[model samples]
Target: MVADKSPKAGVQSVERTFELLEIIASVGGSAALGVLAEHSDLPLPTIHRLLRTLSAMGYVRQLPNKHYALGPKLIRLGESAARLIGSWSQQHLRELVERTGESANMAVMDSDMAVYVAQVPSPHSMRMFTEVGRRVHLHSTGVGKALLMQLPNDAISALVSRTGLPAATENTLTTPDALLRDIDLSRGRGYAVDEGEQEIGVRCFAVPVPDAPTLTAISISGPAARVTLKSATKVAPLLKRIAREVASEFDEHAAG
Candidate 1:
């Protein structure tokens, strides 16, 4: 109980509590207590006590089958964090739009989907339109592939098995093998390309935000006629540069 009153003890307890929550999240956001005990450094009793406290606080919930998952309260926190990150990245996305002459957007993986967090539309009359907060499948968008590239093949396979790679357009890669191969190609080129996968006559190019807080990606998208192969080759560098600036902005935000 001294841990509740001592500053140092309280800090350690908070750290351990968050570490356990992260472990639960890392294993897909639900796990048995024994599974958590195996992954954590804390003893079983400490883990149990922390979980009990968290459950009571509504930050973690125990299922009928005895597994624990992140609770609804964390959803409110996650949504607020996403909005903050989105606001911080907007200026960089605007720079990307200016440099590339295309719409620029930022997305982060939310659960099994990629959700657009920020966007700066192209000045041109014909441009891609992705509303902020719109969730899209991981196999059908440029940001999706860039986000998925952060994960291992096995993790992606497990995810694809669950989501089943629903096709958005004829260009969409609907099979796990195809999506993996495309991601591999994207890795070679250091970016992902939509090539009209999300919508006909639209093309998108995306690169992951390095050292980002989450599986985050920034992209430039526009009509395929305007975003041709030669244009895409040139715009990729600008996207990457903007991504670096965005990462620096996030660092500053965290430090402050």
Candidate 2:
């Protein structure tokens, strides 16, 4: 087949291919060709052609059930991207730690969970420690809530239903309605709090990174004694500012 030489056509083809890949990822990393066609609003022949090209390039694979899954080759790309983003945000997270006197973290939503990508610990001995790459439930962590609050209510309901809202601690929200209420409160207040929700005696405050390319959040956490409600009130503005700065830098890098 002759390749289309028109620039506009080439760009559209690239966009459609990526849109198909995103659809597969959004549907749990695997989907039937018909499903991809329906979701992408593209014809079956076009979907099949794109998937064939992607599979030939080792960017996607055919599953035993005849569905297509993201290929192993993409893992390296994802890890590298995560590391770059984490590196870019480290200074901001360190500044957050200095301002809040707590462990500062950056996380992005992965599948149905919030995955920590970077962190900077507080100076105090009794600081919080959420290891990078740790995945937490959306209803039990400040960063999780911050990311979740960006989703529509119906999407949140579907995710809560899929994950079943299992309790991580006594304070964890175990129902969709309760979690939704908290999400609303977080949106209204411009930040989210995990007050002994993920772990007893620990508290966390988080704000979503403004205009982030992905569903990213930044947070500060520590022993409940130190990250008190009053302290969170004082730190929220700082966290938001850092989030904005990080987002700006990220956008600039992506553009460049």
For all candidates, the clash counts are: 0, 0
lDDT against the true structure, per candidate, is 0.89, 0.89
In the predicted model 2, the residue pairs found to clash are: none
Candidate 1 matches the true fold with a TM-score of: 0.92
Q: What is the lDDT for 72 in model 2?
A: 83
TM-score of each: 0.92, 0.91
- For candidate 2, the 10 contiguous residues with the lowest summed lDDT are 3-12
Residues 38-81 of candidate 2 have per-residue lDDT tens digits of: 89899998898999999999999999999999988887877777
The digit string of per-residue lDDT tens for model 1 on 125-207 reads 88898888899998899999999888889999988887898878899999889999999999988999998999989989999
Q: What is the lDDT of residue 224 in candidate 2?
A: 89
